[model samples]
Target chain A: MTFRSTLAALALAAGFAAPALALDAGTYKVGFVTDNTGPLAFAGTSFTRGAELAAEQISGGGYMAVGAKIELVQKEGAGDAARSIQSYNQLIADRNVIATACCILSPIAGAIKPIALNNKVPLVIYGATAPGLPSLPFVYSVTGLPGPAEVAMSKHIAEVAKPKTVAYFVLSDNEAFQGRFKASQAAMEAAGAKTLGVVSVLSADTDFTAAATQAIALKPDLMMVYTTQSPAAGIIAAVRARGWAGLMSANDAISPLAVFKKIGPPLAGVPFPVNFSADASETPKAKGFIEAYTAKFGAAPDLYSAQGYTAIWLIAQGLKSLPGKPSREALATALNKITELEHDVYGGLPMTNGQAGTRYTLFLNWTPDGKIAAWKP
Target chain B: MDLFLAQLLNGCALGALYGLFGIGFGLVFATMGILNAAQGAYASWAAIIAMYAIELAGLPFPLAALAGIAAGGAVAVLVDQLGFEPLRRFGPGNHQAAMLGALITSIAFWIMLDSAAGLMTGQQSLAFPPGSYPATVFQIGPLLLPAMQAVSLLALAVVGGGMHWLNTRTRFGAAMRAVGWDPVAAALGGVNSRVIVVATAGLAGGISGLAGILAGISTANISAGLGQGLMLKGFAAVVVGGYDDIRGTAIAGLLLGVLEVFCAQYLSSSWRDAFAYALLLGFLMLRPRGLFGGGGFTRA
Candidate 1:
């Protein structure tokens, strides 16, 4: 035989040969859909990087069986849900994506959830944090919804340091954060914290001066805000610029470091609860994740990255539990039956009704020097 | 009453910025009959470049802003050269078809500019330096305006007034108008029509760049994604002010901004946008030519 023919014959033989372990081994595709290039690009980039690292470690014997190789079928969105639906269908048809990890935005998840469920592919949602979505047969969440933390924060203000009057600046279009506002308001008002007013803002709003003027006119004791990082930075700056400084608070939407960078030295000491923080990564799993993540990405992982890393590991646990040949149907069964997952970036995540939300209890605050630290309050 | 005054001042400042941006959006459409969607992109690129000019180049804030505005004009001319110039010169052999082709090309350029800015900045939100705005507040008793906003209002007056004068009184402006009326006739009249087109593109871009910098300076939450949003509002300003009149377009933008603030203040905040649109729609029904257009609405 010619040398080229001999090489081709050897490659074909190696491809067909199945030795290794009696586990679900050899190239498996996990479809990951994220908003990698848009307004919330930070979330998508961080999540996908962590997932990529998790895939690398799993493929290199970090978690599951060494030979249980996984291929991440990555897809990105630029705030287009139609494109996401199209990509999901394409990936399922061509690549046979066994399971899917989807979305940083709740809107995108709302769009693609029906497709995965109808296809019987186990969908692990990473970012969209609306409540009780895991009630669906094929749906599970690896990231915590903001409900628990929002409720707790509201109660903390009312019971611990109740302010008499409060005003809010909310993202008008985000149904999730708007719901977050209601959850927070119910707790605060139940204890008699009268709401002064609500100033609705769109993601497009650049000037919060008018909104600031209106909010200051109310002269509330506490200024409650629920907006993503960009608008959060804008609102805070506007209010501060207008010389209204009673008290200010916000949800995890404003917790990213980018917010702090945008509005430097303006009340950086405000503490907020988040799912995970690099400073509070004490568990063996979290420590390993930080080390591995930093080594791979050349930077420590943030909350979004932690979400992606833990979520992929959660999917890996399902893959490991499959006793026979791996199929989307079998993986769904394994994940549905999974109540316990070890070494979740959440540190042994306790799944309740196939939903894993609420990471280890950790609150983070920005120091005057702009470093993140554990918040005692 | 004090709260009302505060809202008025705040709205006026914001309205001024919106009006300034609308000048560019309407400038191109009024003169060239081409709705330039990339006007917001010019602004986004200006802000991004200004951020770098401040941080990387170590230039003082005003000089950096000027540099950024200059870059905006340069980019606008380049876009015209690539996207619109070709279509205007050699299109589908009909005026309507060429106009449609140019519109599509402008929209494409708009998306391309947004993507290019996003790529250059790694889709990250970049803010100006900490002391970019003065800490001084322009206050009159209960009414207050930040120094940044005060500066923005002043800029709009100078730039807007200068543009009006140039368009009405200057020879170049007259040539631009002649070109707008009929490019072939203007060329026959010894006006270099293509040069006039390029110059108009630069002016529109510079105006947008100035508006973008002013908007970015206000809250320091600058992002490339902000372009499309601003473009929509700019279009609204153009339509409401009168499509073919720059001064009316500017005033209409101001009115829209003020109306939005008042709606949010007096009406329900969540329903403010709906309220503003409803009011504008009613006004437009009465005055179809817009707030200060050439003719009033009339029934035959």
Candidate 2:
């Protein structure tokens, strides 16, 4: 048999076998679409842990709306846009799933959100904070909007940093990320901080020697890096290689401990914002969540995990509110009515209505030793 | 001035790597008229093999590098025998077809190797731990060179010098030149042109492998596409240096590296790649035959 045919057969077998497992009492079938095996796999894995634990907790009678159980069917999106749409379609059509939770990249989620809406499957985005997502009726974003992170960054810079001049570096490949970062730059400029030029680099670029040298020449008091982990690591190395001693601030795209581990001493005093802290065991809920996640996954949870956990919990809450096996319409209605969701899952991020839509976000900064501490704004 | 000097030094150090790979590319073109696209894949395979030997099997660095070079040479021979020989039998007029075949085979090999490596080890950046080598710095006046960079430069010089000697002084080199100057006449004169061709490929592959190993060591990590970008730069360097001129290829490689560094430092870093291509274009327009264009050979 051909490899393609073999793969197809395997997929069919897995799909058939998925529903054979005994369903828990009152368990409402939910589908999870995620990029579990791609460049963003690390984030996906963490998010999956959150979703899995939430599903387990709901099944174990931790919190139920009325008389419904939750069963999650996980599918790997592999970070491809077309694959995510296919996965979402399959979940909605094949599984007859009422709600879908995803931790796929923004572009993939953005494309799949419309499909979810058309199919009447309530879509909850866990990790991605893409701007246009919250505006969609069927789509509910548990993560904060991209604008809040930028605004919080600007506020922090103005209050604590108070640097005379700041230079901006952003990945040119991602239009959504670049647009949000550009707004932050404009805000920084408006807040009486001199804006040096914005340097655009390719997302896959490794060598930062030239970029770092140019930024050094600018002699900015502060440098803002708006990029993901890989390039951010390279940029930090390049900056340190040139012996630049300015304060460095990064956007939420920067992975706190992961970036710190890769960059080591170069990232000393470099501050970046994150939405959740895995190390935070302050509140009972936070502590319990950490213990349960660690027990299940054998590792600490990050922002992705917290967001994933919150997304599933929110979906479960919606599912609980429904009478008897909840339909997609019921789930969508339930999600729309969700006003203030205070869960220990994400340090009690309040979901409130803003001019655009629901705004749910928090900020955390990284210590030099790579500890993620909550950044109180 | 100090920063400029530092950047210049940095550029030269990086350019040496480009020069090393360009020399291999120029060697094959000068000896055999084939633009071996397989050169880059062979280099990557060699580097990965070396990394595997060192990391997985606990082999010494030197042994691992030797194994890598040997593996590169073997792969080059395999490509010549399987890919080039069949096309060469079709006559020189099918050079375009030959180039396309080589490119496809090389790309196929690269993808297979990359996927296999990625699957074998989970998609994680393979890094050499800190202090794998002594972190000493060599300073001469205002110039500061890291020990790793210095070693890389020194290795390049030795390999480059050895290649120059082999090409100019050796009997094999003379036979290869005779074959290139007139293959029919050289064959009639009983100079084994097939052997010469294979030897040239092997030598080029060995050099490329060494370049890959050095890059891996210096960067402390290796990815699937490590050789792809480097190979493009190497090809550009050869074109800018004059396709068949070995020394010119080396010089062009170093010059290109320095240009990239300067652009990254003085101008916008985002434009570094743009600047590198622009320099190549400007140089090509000024000197169509390349900086030292003398050898009558065409490149793809």
Candidate 3:
């Protein structure tokens, strides 16, 4: 025989003798829809990075079996309703991703969720805190809704500030935040705080002079502000600029370090809730994942990253334990079986009411020197 | 009583800032018979540039403010050259067509400027540097006054008084008024109409920039879209006070600001804009000639 024909014969024999694991190797495609390049760009990118890391770990035989790999499809939603729905459809219809994961803003979730439900695609949601959404079937939230977090935060603030009277300076246009304002107010009132008054302003309002002045006039001991980081910073500065000595409290909307950077010293001493902290987490896998993520991404994981990483790992676990080549429905069933998960970055997270239960939020105060420390309740 | 007095002072300070910005809108409309839709964009750009100067370059606040004003003036000159001037040179034959063309061009410039500033901070507003304004409060009898409010009011008075002088006193002021009344007639009477137009635009833009800085100092936050709200209120002031009446525009602006504040204080802050706009709509319906119209400031 010729040398080339002899080599071909040997390769054929070797292929027949190879392990069956090679033949069983397959890829599960997952789509990620998020506001990656828009207003929520930093958050969306962090979520994407975390998911990517989890996919890498799982497919590379570190977190799961070696033969199966996960292929991630990413799309930018820009947090727009129409755009998010379009991106979801394109990912499902065109890319044929078996499942999808998204993060950050609740408005995007509200927009694309109906589409996911009708199409019977298993959609995983993260970070969106608008309440009344945990009941949706086929739509799983890795992070709990805003109701529990705000309630917890309000109770915490009442304990820390000990204010007799609290006023709300809310951005009326943010539907989610606005919707929670009443519940949060009730929570505070129930916690032995008096409701001073509620001052509402448009989201585009740069000058909060009138609103702040009006609120300050009421002599409230604490101000509960609901707005994005940019405007929240403005409102805080405006309130302080008016020489009001009252304490201020806000929700997680104003919690990111980037927000503190924008707000500078004004944000110091202000308490807000955070969903996760790598340094403070006690989950065994969380420490290892944090080190691995930092080693891979060259930055410590934030709340979004932690949640995103957990979300992908959750999906991977479902895919791994499934009996055979998993269909979308089967994968979703496998995911439903995991009532609680030991997260790599956030310790233990339990699922309830068809979604992750409300996790305990950590309250932190920014120090004068730009460091964050846990608040003593 | 203290609360009421404090709210009153707040309204007045807000009014002064509104008037300062209103002057820019009033100037462009009075001179060219075109709505300067980009007026707010100029204010937004000024705030961004001022923040960059103070934060990144570490310039003193006052110097940074001056730099911002200069940038606003430069942009104003560019807008006049690129937008209004072009429309006038190669405009449609009809007056309505020319006005429409100018409006569209001005709005386009506004969007471009707003988008550019938004890109600088990834669509997030930046806080003014600490000490951009005096955070301390000054007590005057029963009223506790914020130092920034006092400073802003004083600055507005000085600028408004200077604007009044420039419009009614100097030979150049007379020339501008004459041109505003009738460009062809002023040209025939030996007035350099082009110089008047360019000078008016720059002066208006500088005033808008100063308003922007003062607003930023007051709120301690400067968003890229700051100018939009200001522009809306300023336009409303111009329409309510009579387009060419500069003093009337200032007074109207102050009135609107005070009214809005009172609405927020007594009614709902959410309804403040609705009430203010409703009042404007009422004025337009009841008296199209405006509160101070027919004074010949813009009479052809």
Chain B TM-score for each model? 0.93, 0.90, 0.95
DockQ metric, candidate 3 = 0.52
Error of 3 at A192 (Å): 3.1
Misplaced by over 4 Å in model 2 are A1-105, A117-121, A150-162, A176-199, A252-257, A327-329, A341-344, A352-377, B1-3, B24-95, B134-156, B172-206, B213-221, B262-271, B278-300
Decide which is better by DockQ, 1 or 2: 1
Measured by TM-score, the strongest candidate is 1
Clash count of each predicted structure: 0, 3, 2
lDDT of 1 by residue, B64-86 (tens): 89988998899999999998888
**Interface RMSD for every prediction, one decimal?**
1.7, 3.4, 2.8
Per-residue lDDT tens digits of candidate 1, residues A88-118? 7777775467888887777778778888888
Name model 3 segments beyond 4 Å from true.
A1-33, A36-77, A86-93, A101-107, A134-137, A157-162, A171-175, A278-335, A341-344, B295-300
Fraction of true contacts kept, per model? Answer: 0.66, 0.13, 0.55
Per-prediction DockQ: 0.57, 0.27, 0.52
Give candidate 1's error at residue A346 in angstroms: 3.0
Q: For candidate 3, write residues A301-346 as lDDT tens digits.
A: 7777877887787787766666545667776776777787744455
TM-score of each: 0.92, 0.77, 0.86
Q: Tell me the tens digit of each residue's lDDT in model 2 across B1-300.
A: 766876777777778878888888777777776666657766676777887787678877778889988887887788778777776676446656666766666666656655554453344444333334334666767555667667767876887788767777999878878876767789999999899988988988888877777766555445555566678889888889887667778888889889988875566556778888987888777775788877464445
RMSD of 2: 9.6
* Local distance difference test, each candidate: 0.78, 0.71, 0.77
| Residue lDDT tens for model 2, A175-282 | 767877878777887888888767667766655655666677678988888876666767766676555777887765555355554455566666655555666535
